[model samples]
Target: MTLRRLPDLTWEDVGALDLDRTVAILPVGATEAHGPHLPLDTDVTIAAAMAEAGGRRLSAHGLEAVLLDALQYTPAAFAASFPGTISIGGATLAALLTDLAASVQRAGIPTLAIANAHFDPTHLRALHTAVSAINAGGVLRAVFPDVTRRPWGGRLTAEFRSGACHAGQYEGSIVLARSPERVRGEVMRELDDNPVSLSAAIAEGAQDFVAAGGPQAYFGSPAAATAEEGHATIETLGDILSEAVIDALGTETWPRTKEQT
Candidate 1:
């Protein structure tokens, strides 16, 4: 059967799909400053692209998957001091997530996965809380955060550690890869220093990275970012996410409890 994108699918069409077999992917991102070089919508753009790629792959495998509209407005506590940054409080973000998950459950989609591109603490907490609620409600079987888990997580994590993960090389590369025109290469050259190291601070549950000594509200070497690396990262992340979705669909526990549905 030909797969239908969620945006294109009518309410009747969604209602017709086997609810038990359908999967919904929600792309979660934040509107935050990524230095002067990148657009404020970087997170949403990347998350949406990744989710679309994953949905296509799942559909190719005969499992139905659709990309939901992104949850773009989110917590940007780290970049709160920066202009053009739009962030919400933790409680607000959690409420949004909970409502979205509940809507998906009511729509009859058995599996729901949130594809997150931003790493804000508040955003993470909200997402986790939503997943917990969905799981408790017995409407969702599995929820995969950071779709990089199964196949390419190790590689991505390694790259992230190698000065590519932060707003520097890795994120810049993705922005360039997804939309070269949106990147300001010259501006990136000026903010080339690593912002702050979170290895120690994160353990203590700090909210803002800038407050922890990352003055520029960025990290890693922006000069090192390349369109090639961005493309490679996206492709790798997409592959891993696809495999994860397929695996989740194949599991018996997925869409775990049928009592509520």
Candidate 2:
């Protein structure tokens, strides 16, 4: 079955679906500064690509996949100083996620899977809080494969694992693969590698991009990004999301065990 975009389907179309075997994939991202070379929506692009890929994979596994519109506004305190960065309250984001899951549950969808690329601490915390609330509700299952954590973190490219990957080769490559036109080719080629790890900075009590040693709102190697690497990394991200969803479902059986009586 082809992966469906939720917005494109009418109420009748959605009502006709066997929601028991369906998964709604939400692409979570942030509208924040990446670098001089990349667009502010870079995270959104990557998240959408991951969701698309993951949705296809879920379809292959016999579950109907529905792609929800991207979640673009989130807490981005780390990059708040940047000109185009838009930051929201962590509590607000958490509440939104919780409510979203409740609505999905009421619509009869069994699972909501997140395809996230933004890694701001505030944003991560919000996601954690919302997922906890969603699961506690006991109706909707929220599947979040947090790439910043262990196991999932280990599966990405070296640049991603380095913790200095904000708008660096890791993210730049994915943007290059998914939306090359959004990249500033001239500036990207001249950028020097900023290997200071943002993760390490946060651990050491640093706040915001400048304090993390990324004065230009960037980190790691940007000049080294390639579409090939981006594609590969997206595939890895997709696999991570798909596997998480499957695991959360508690079985490989996508087919419903019994008819809905």
Candidate 3:
């Protein structure tokens, strides 16, 4: 019933785990620009929070959740112009994901769940490719709850759904909740609203953050962010990840209950 950090455990501890009931949760993020208010590793912080919360939920449901070391370097071309943004090739990310999955499979873990917070187009495409490749190999099941689409996206806040939420309220709130010390509160409060939807701009052929209408590497309303809202959003993210993993396992061991929701 305890959630474990895989990196913190000894080889003996890992080897003794009931692998059949264990799910390794990988926190995937990007070292990219999130505006002047937030840190470059903003996505890394959010992904870690999601993974920890999801791992706790899985543990509550009688599953063994193992948290893996975060994958922080990812494709982040949109933020490439920013000073500290580290963008990698999408193919490199895909190959790394595949290799990680295969490594986990070899270590007796049957399921690998990704808790990803970065949503750059190239990064997302790489994730989809990696997930597909991992599943096709049949070595182990890889579950990715793509938060940008469908049911998952709908469950998030209005700012996030608006797609103008790079370093804005949506992401800023999470950073505030997880690492308040990193937020440049004075600058965040003075920033004007940039309601332009990055998604819509991308659809119109915009490539980077500037072309996407985020000259400051941000969009939406940053001043609107709150720690409470960030906590709520993190909880929702946890729900999305836990539900996806449970569904992927497809077992009747954990029955759904009204109270659980």
> Clashes in each model (backbone N, CA, C under 3 Å)?
2, 0, 0
Please give the lDDT score at residue 6 for candidate 3. 89
| Per-model CA lDDT versus the true structure | 0.73, 0.92, 0.93
Instruction: Give the TM-scores of the predictions, in the order they appear.
Output: 0.85, 0.96, 0.97
lDDT of 1 by residue, 1-261 (tens): 344568898999999897777778888888988777888888888888777777776666556787788888998887888898998988898777777777787898888877788877667777777677767877576566453333345667444754334577878888898888998888887775674565345656666666555666666778888888888887766766666676665645333324325
Best by lDDT: 3
Pairs with backbone N, CA or C atoms under 3 Å apart (clashes), candidate 1: 141-255, 195-219
TM-score of 1: 0.85
Off by over 4 Å in 2: 255-261
lDDT of 2 by residue, 1-261 (tens): 779999999998988888898999999999999989999999999999999999988887778899999999999999999999999999999999998988889889989999999999999999999999999988889999999998899999998888989999999999999989989989999999999999999999998999989999999999999999999998998899988998899674665334311
Off by over 4 Å in 3: 254-261
If the candidates were sorted by their TM-score against the true structure, best first, what order would they fall in?
3, 2, 1
Candidate 3 structure lDDT? 0.93
Clashing pairs in 3: none
RMSD of each: 5.3, 3.5, 1.4
Return the lDDT, model 2, position 147.
Answer: 92
Q: Considering lDDT, which of the candidate structures 1 and 2 is the better prediction for this target?
A: 2
Query: What's the true lDDT of residue 129 in model 1?
Result: 77
